[model samples]
Target: MFFKPYMRSLAVAASLAVLAGCSSTGGTQDGSMDGTGAAGGVGTGTAGSGQVSGTGMGGNGAGQMASTGIPDVRTIYFDYDSDTIRSEFESVVNAHASYLAGNPNARVILQGHTDERGTREYNLALGERRAGAVQRYLSLRGVSPSQVEVVSYGEERPAVRGSNEDSFAQNRRVVFAY
Candidate 1:
């Protein structure tokens, strides 16, 4: 009986932690989703060459697959339904942030995306949050706010087409277009 109360308290704390982990900064309390008029394209490419091919957000047709001096790790991926950046991508992002800091004229577009599972609105919001997380990380590392542009394609543009976990893993990512 002595340990029962402590176990109960522990259980409550764990439940709260799980709830907090699943909370998102997207959508209204009424379940209505809002869209941001951000612009960007979708696609994936070889990391070594740093080439991305896709239509520009507004039909610019400027998207091409070529290494334009971008770093090898241009894409930062996130886990399922979470906007937090994974630990493995931290150094890569930091490298990009450092490069941005060194070159004020260098501009990058952070295209946020998500897998096809959640509601369109939720995915979009999650994408935005993921991109925002990277933006905040860059800012923390001394990158200027003006140097980065954020856009969320959500589930509309996927890197891979499939319902399997592999495709979903590839789909959930933030690509840096320079």
Candidate 2:
């Protein structure tokens, strides 16, 4: 009886732990499936049928790619279904801002993306929001508005392919194309 009670206690503890972990964040493990816009409908559903090219910006098109090449910082990853830029990408965006400040004529393109989870339309809007977040970050840092343009490819193009969290994380990102 003692051993039986102990086992029961252990099982309950384990179950509680599992539930707690999942509840820390809102929505299901698959954000897009929750139907709550908290995740912005960007979830890693599966490989999308639309296989558009995913050429994230690495350098500005005006020979910047050939001249300056790509800096060490090129890609910024975001949380599932979120357009808020993470603090980790602050340095990269600041560097881009500094570069733009120095090169008045240089232009940059911000390409936003989302994992294949939500509806295509939702993902497209989410992608645009992500790009706009980056644009705002750069603009706040003294980068000229004329130097920036934003595009949203949505989930049509993925940096990585898969429905799993790891792949989804890779696909949810903004490319800093100069």
By TM-score, who's the top model here?
Answer: 2
* Residue 177 alpha-carbon offset, candidate 1, angstroms: 0.6
C-alpha TM-scores of all predictions: 0.62, 0.63
Residue 145 local lDDT, model 2: 96
User: Model 2: per-residue lDDT, tens digit, 90-163?
Assistant: 45566677778778898989998887876788778778777876787678768899999999898888886777
Runs in model 2 deviating more than 4 A are 1-70
Q: Pick the candidate with the highest lDDT.
A: 2
**Candidate 1, run of 10 with poorest lDDT:** 42-51
Global CA lDDT of candidate 1, please? 0.57
Report the lDDT tens digits of candidate 1 across residue range 11-78. Answer: 22222221123233421111111122212321121111211222212121122122244566688665
- C-alpha lDDT of residue 137 in model 2: 69
Locate the minimum summed-lDDT window of 10 residues in model 2: 1-10
Cα lDDT, model 2, residue 96? 74
Poorly placed runs, candidate 1 (over 4 Å): 1-69
